[model samples]
Target: MVSDRRYCRWPRSSRERTCISSIGPLLQPSSDALEKQFDSWQLRITPVDYLLGVADLTGELMRMCINSVGNGDIDTPFEVSQFLRQVYDGFSFIGNTGPYEVSKKLYTLKQSLAKVENACYALKVRGSEIPKHMLADVFSVKTEMIDQEDGIS
Candidate 1:
């Protein structure tokens, strides 16, 4: 009699396992499921590519946090901050050994994390003083100040 239980194999390298496991829950699908789906579509992505994509996700999440604030939703920024921090921690495992491209994105990822943290800071500090409708304006001013300080404009 054959048992119905399935034996699964995880990636051999702790790094690959960390990268896949880190991104899995944020994507709302397990890494195994994503792999199966990609396989069915004949798609392939190296671990480096996957890490790069997740790094890029930080920027999108930053935008989302800001948009949530614009809509007067005060809680999402903190949630995004928590998620971004987890992503950042996962990347820390790669450290200086990651590819040059990933290294470059790590700098960007830090910047995105900082922006979200700053937004959350502003909300926590000034939230009580500002009206709900004007919170977006406050975020815009804060972003402008940050951009100017960074010499982006």
Candidate 2:
């Protein structure tokens, strides 16, 4: 009998597995999946690369928070807040042990985290006060504050 299930067989090569493993934790795969990946590949991810990838998560989080606010999504911001806190805690613990490259990423990660935090705070404190459409429209602004001198405008 021909089975209809997908993933009937694993990748034929470690290189293919390596490519798949490079997808990172953005999908938040379960521990079982991770175990399977490691067992299948018999490969260990590099710490610097892993840290860099983790650092990259902050940008995705910031965008998520922004979109959540724009969509009047109260729950997502809270969830993202908790996730960021966990990431921050982990970063603070090992941040100093990392290489110079990680330090650069740490700076960027901090900035992204702050932006998400502020967005969450705004949503929590002002969510009820602001109309849904107005809140959503807030994300659609084309020109950033030109007076700030950030040159985003």
Candidate 3:
């Protein structure tokens, strides 16, 4: 009479054990079932979109600065200064521009902004306000022009 058993009685040979161990897990059903699952993920805004947004904001601020200068609204000068600073800080985090270039541009802008602020303060302290028409005279030149005029060579 033969005994009926599911497992082998003797120790398995190394080759047999290796094959059995490798094949055993595949025979079981996994709880995760990752192979059968599906999902989708995507970004709402691409990096290009972010860069364009920054550029647009920068352009708008520049336009505002020009308008403020032309209008002689001293407060606008300060606002423009703050706006440029904010843009610089944001760009620093994004790293879209090289550090040296960005820093140079930022410093130049800041210096001009500070000059505008000081001029406005002086005018105010002298018991006079900047005329709107003089805004052009205040922020008329480009940052590069100011740098060149200042002999920043």
| Deviation from native of the Cα of residue 91 in model 2, angstroms | 0.9
lDDT for each candidate structure = 0.73, 0.59, 0.47
| TM-score per candidate | 0.69, 0.63, 0.42
Q: Per-residue alpha-carbon lDDT of model 3 for 18-133, expressed as tens digits?
A: 21122232244434556336432222444554444444445455555556556555565555555566666666574635545444445544554555554445445631554556
For residues 1-153, could you state the per-residue lDDT of candidate 2 as single tens digits? Answer: 011111221233423422123333323433577677765433344678667766676566667667877776767666666667778777877776778877777766666666666666667787778787687555434113311333332
lDDT, candidate 1, 13-42, per-residue tens: 434433222232223333577667765322
Please rank every candidate by lDDT, starting with the best. Answer: 1, 2, 3
Q: Which stretches of candidate 1 lie over 4 Å from their true place?
A: 1-43
Candidate 3's C-alpha lDDT?
0.47
What is the Å distance of residue 110 in model 1 from its true position? 0.9
Measured by lDDT, the strongest candidate is: 1
Of candidates 2 and 1, the better by lDDT? 1
In candidate 3, which residue ranges exceed 4 Å CA deviation?
Answer: 1-44, 96-132, 142-144, 147-153
RMSD of each: 11.6, 11.3, 26.6
